[model samples]
Target: NKVSGSNAYVKSCRRDGVTRWSDGNTVSGCDGGEAFVCNSQMPWAINDQLAYGFAAASIPGLTEQQRCCACYKLDFTSGPVVGKSIIVQVVNSGPDVNPNQFDLQIPGGGVGIRNACSSQWNAPSDGWGQRYGGVSSRQDCYSLPAAIRDGCLFRFDWFKGADNPTMVYSKVTCPAELVARTECSRSD
Candidate 1:
């Protein structure tokens, strides 16, 4: 299935061991009480023109269970990353996500509605930057844990610091690399 729109933006979620519906267990480095965003959910560049990443999406008509682990090929139509494509696997979802939004899970990207980074990584209450848009520069990536710093840098480098680029998206097969990270596959 495919959907085209101008409302999409690659919002960032904070990194921590969060209990996501797709993966029932908490990722390492956080107490078991709350599930934070997994560090492995971070996005990475496959090449200058392409990338592979994970996102927590809200697609109208699909429940979280239906969306989890599903892959989408996003062809950017605007902003610095216009024309570049990224294949992202849906690993998380939330009620706050507006319809058609894919919140890319970048480490230094803002924590959105959650703040487990303070408990898991000792980050500030609002995370590395503004609560909604995260770290302003590549240098801020250094503040993230080593395991996820590369993903933060990816936003500044491969992603070209594009602020919420709009994209045309379609459902696609999940890549093995992404499946290996989330250990999830949609039954549908």
Candidate 2:
């Protein structure tokens, strides 16, 4: 969806807080009222180990089932966030979010940790080692990470405004060793 870099911001998901959804239930897309470790685990946590991810209000045309485990690669183009990019997954839905806007996890979103999210995997300061913003900017959208063809791991591709985006997103899947403990389903 070619999210103008200016439109993206940073947000973290935690297993705590009354208003927050459990990581176990969040990712399962519980259409049948069944939770699948969606809110119980963090994207970075392996059976309580720390992990990372981001959130969004709504994607272009994906159903709730399609949103879970969805990934997007954000490349910042301006401000203190220039020349940096990180991959994030869809862990929570933000009804209040504007179109083309994203709420990135503090760790992977480049935002310094602030104890706002779960600290299962690592310290708050360990968040993506940086932070972006809540302002409007420009960023290029791609389904696959840079230099995908040069790697051995499976690659998943996506567009900024794709229709009915799938769960097989590039960044959503936890590595094989980590998946047994976390909720992120394996795409491969």
For each candidate, what is the lDDT? 0.76, 0.34
Instruction: Give per-residue CA lDDT, model 2, range 59-144, as digits (tens).
Output: 66765455555566555454433443445565556555445555543212332223232233332343222233311111221211
Model 1, position 14, has a per-residue lDDT of 33
TM-score of 2: 0.38
Which candidate achieves the best TM-score against the true structure? 1
Model 1 misplacement above 4 A: 1-34
Error of 2 at 98 (Å): 1.6
RMSD of each: 6.9, 14.6
The digit string of per-residue lDDT tens for model 1 on 1-188 reads: 11122112122223434333333443322343444556667798888898999887999898776777789999999999998999998866754578999988788888888666778788898989988899999998998888779999999999988888999899998888887666666545
**Clash totals, every prediction:** 4, 40
TM-score of each: 0.82, 0.38
Residue-level error in angstroms, candidate 2, position 158? 25
Query: Native-vs-model 2 lDDT?
Result: 0.34
